[model samples]
Target: MNPTQKMSLQAIDLVGPSQPLVSLIINNYNYAAFLAEAIDSCLNQTYPRIEVIVVDDGSQDGSPQIIESYGAKIIPVLKANGGQASAMNSGFSVSAGEIVIFLDADDYLIPNAVETIVARWQPETAQLHYRLTVVNTEGEAVGFCPSPGVQLATGTVWPILLKRGRYHSNVTSGNAFSRSALDKVLPIPETDFRIAADGYLVGAVPFWGSVAAIEEPLGCYRQHSSNAWSNSQSTEDPQKLVKRLRWALKHDLHRYYWIQHQAKALGHPTQENLGLRDYMHLIDRLASLRLDPEQHPFASDASAGIARKGIGAVWQQDCLSTGRKLALLGWFAIAGFMPSLFATPTIEWFLLPTSRPQFIQKTIRGIKSLRVA
Candidate 1:
């Protein structure tokens, strides 16, 4: 650690009871190979006073044994297989920290992530605020940020969001949250949303809290060919691709439905959308579905003609770049014939945060004031 980092840790140690220690809650599900690294990264933080909670989602991979290796510093919770959302809900229920953070088992935080996040939390107008931070995996920057008119929900809306790419594509899972925020947004439903649950949780956050952006790389996200969806994409096998496509379609539809729900819930107009790209993609996906013989048992000739017309319209609209247009055309063809491969990007880049000078100036001032006293 640098001298500045050493001093920062010393200062955090000096913070009083008025400032509660942040809790880092990680949801582990059979990723034992990566769990230790994630935990170790938390252990090496320059900021002091963080409790680590690991919820093992019934991993028969002996993940419980690995977590136990950390002894008391890391608390391990074992539950039946209830998926990521349930694991998070379980961790949230037991954590006592005033500020809560959720970290995925495969991801880890940067050295000063907690300190930087805590600095952004002291809003004069509210108890909890949504802080945005940038991160890089393997030393490469992931350029993603929230766009204008886009509001943040609680914690971090990483895996499930429309304007997700605006926050950086390679964001790690260890995002900090204020305790009050969780209290207000509790019992995050353990829905069987194959892909877009994170978006729903984020959209559900109230608009009253403040939103801050932290412009520093705080962690690493390890991506490999062995992930859950990786194999589905690697095969020419029709059944596998079909299964993947169905999951994607259902997930995206659910995401859009919830986006509308949250917009209305917050008294915001449901139709004033930011992700035109997503909307186009949705339409493209829907239009492609007209070709499946099984899906449309009757009127085979009409369905084929409609599919050709829809594909031609997408090509002529030039809604995307040449490559994106071609890609969409190909996807449309696949969706037409195979009727699969439809879903939201687990990590998305919908609307980017406004680059207006006022917001920039405000962010600059806040960051400039974050140095250790």
Candidate 2:
């Protein structure tokens, strides 16, 4: 045999088993508009050893048809409307890959996404995270979201999760989790996670092992008003902003309650809980207080208390840029010291992208692009 051919065969043998199969699970619920693109992205991943599983959560639209159209190219899970968590549980039960990724139907991965995650895989890692480009309903780039800081929060991040109840991690589509990590926390409580199912997983997975980060965009996260989780929508209505803050508050609380249980089970109980110390949550609290003081949830939550805690949060935030910190600091001050009537409008301006002047939105989007760059 030729020496080169023999060496190649020997190298193959030394490299051990075939590449691990990656299960790309796409969860859909009335996202038929974008379902096909999401499935195509998974099927077309650069990684050769991968399986695409599409879970339709009783989508009434064309989602089932799209899934059917994929034929044998993908595995299909059709079930009654059970929300995001149920769909996730259903999908993973049938999956057989060493690496697993849950891609949202409204999102699509770049060709190299799975290939890159597989290349970066480590035996000790529980999960790997990457950034995502924010896009509109029409698939147009609308903005970018940076990691919570200059560098992603990685490695033994349970302590961060314990104190702050959050870390630098992206939504569902931006993460590829080890099967070992997922096994520990699967069957996510359906009712608790009907929306933002990724939040529970993101918090629970890091406790099992070290986490990793890719630090660049791997997919597109489409945002629109009709989204199940309407974060970063382009709506300008004042009442809608108030309603969103309330929804965010509830979601954050659910995340904390669930993660706390996961942590205690692992013997990593939090000595001091900083769950409410989150800057964004505080912003939500402060804004809610101003917008509708009568219905504000926290009884002891005064504007001053929120501002003080928010200042501390912003100061210690490892994920945000200095400019962002400064802006938040100024916001807290206004919300704390200014009259409610004045601060309410200002808060809405910051919270709603459509409320801002076009130039300002363009400028902010431009600045955020540098973070991903």
The superposed Cα distance between candidate 2 and the true structure at residue 85, in angstroms, equals: 0.5
RMSD of each: 11.9, 2.7
Candidate 2 ranges with C-alpha deviation above 4 Å: 1-7, 13-16, 147-150, 271-273, 358-373
Write down the lDDT of every candidate, Cα atoms only: 0.54, 0.84
Error of 1 at 178 (Å): 2.6
Candidate 2 lDDT, 161-194, residue by residue in tens? 7777788778888888999889999889898888
Q: Which stretches of candidate 1 lie over 4 Å from their true place?
A: 1-14, 122-174, 194-196, 206-208, 230-239, 260-277, 280-373
lDDT of 1 by residue, 128-161 (tens): 3233333333434343223112233333332233
On a 0 to 1 TM-score scale, where does candidate 2 land against the true structure? 0.92
